[model samples]
Target: MDLPRTFTIRESEHRIHNPFDERKLADLGAALHLKPGMRMLDLASGSGEMLCSWARDHRLTGTGVDVSTAFTAKARARAAELDVAEQVSFVHGDASGYVSSEPVDVAACIGATWIGGGVAGTIELLRRSLRPGGLMLIGEPFWRKTPPDRETVTACHMGSRDDLFALPGLVAHFGRIGYDQVEMVLADQDSWDRYAAAQWLNTRRWLDQNPEDELAAQMRAELTAAPLQHILYQREYLGWGVFVLMAR
Candidate 1:
């Protein structure tokens, strides 16, 4: 199983595949005070940046599972490039319902919580693979500002504003779910721009190379409209962050 070709095409260059930069990721690794030899399990682990980087820098070991064959290959290449191929590995498989064979020091479902249906279900999924006192990392979106109406919510690709909690509400949710939020690194508008805006360029470059490809027209339309849509809706109303949690 794999992600849609469109997704791979658009995010082909993204190491993290979410609205996060290297600095933010480094900040997260640092904040965790990761000691060498810790184990992590990252579900929906796009391109394996976090795992590979942490493996190299923190001397952590991890397995990353992803649904994208293309991204899985990239992740493996990244691990090799970082000289941490022995420490981290990527599996090309569905992350949904994936429980680790062994409990890990960290269990994560970053950005693609749909693997477990939603945030709460995803947390439950992650918990199954976490060792006692281990951390769970969730990367999710919250309402940066409550959308004024349905149109804005739709523009942000949300079914309804109710689908997302505000920042404070989301943190409160962790407590309600038997976890305490101990650390977080949030994405600002600039990171959103880096994530979404870069897709436009990737689409454009792809279109230039294969104007007659089956998906070219769709990509062209997206390239034309995505910038304005991102600026108008996503960059303003949606906030994203990776939160670190431990069971209470």
Candidate 2:
């Protein structure tokens, strides 16, 4: 019903769960040109940031579903704080195989395609809830550059180079899957720093306060190594972006 404790604790203060900053999130929402009152269905919607913020800024109405109970609660509170509670709602449930009860203007699964196995399968799942000609949003990572070896790939947390495409290949992939890539917003190294580096502080603070906790050792080890690991592997080889698509 929730993310693993260590993960939740590590990202305890994250309002947006991915490697996207608030500015990028706003730009992505604006790029959609979503009309007022448009309905969106968001799967794996961590903390409902996209839904709630869009509800407030774009006058969007949406539902967000995620398996993380802690994040779901934060999402609800966020909706209320933004005065978008009536427009956006969040549900604490597994997003895998989820479909909206009604057709929506947008169907999204941001940074959590594993909910449906991968990009193609996740798209199929989202298609079930999208209105004809409606938009779909997928946030995913791509290869900035090919890794040098299996070790580098593993350092990037990917099983192999086949796990993702380079930027051009990723766009071509959408075409191959029968979708038109209408728009996209990419994340730079700065965004990656914000996303990954922020975890260190959170982990450090938690360790300082809960030194006796069982997970402290694990977090300490991770915090110790994650920064340089990210700089050496991910910052140079990995990239992320939110892509907008429509049925072709």
Residues 44-107, model 1: lDDT tens digits: 9999999999998899999999999999999999999999999988999989978999999999
Which parts of model 1 have CA positions greater than 4 angstroms off? none
Model 2 error, position 150 (Å): 1.8
* lDDT digits (tens) for residues 1-248 of candidate 2: 67899889878989988999999999999999989989999999988888998998999898999999999999999999999999988989999968899999999999999998999999999999999999999999999998989989999999999999999998998999999999999999999999998888889999999999999889999999999999999999999999999998
User: What is the Cα-based TM-score of model 2?
Assistant: 0.98
Which pairs in model 2 have colliding backbones?
none
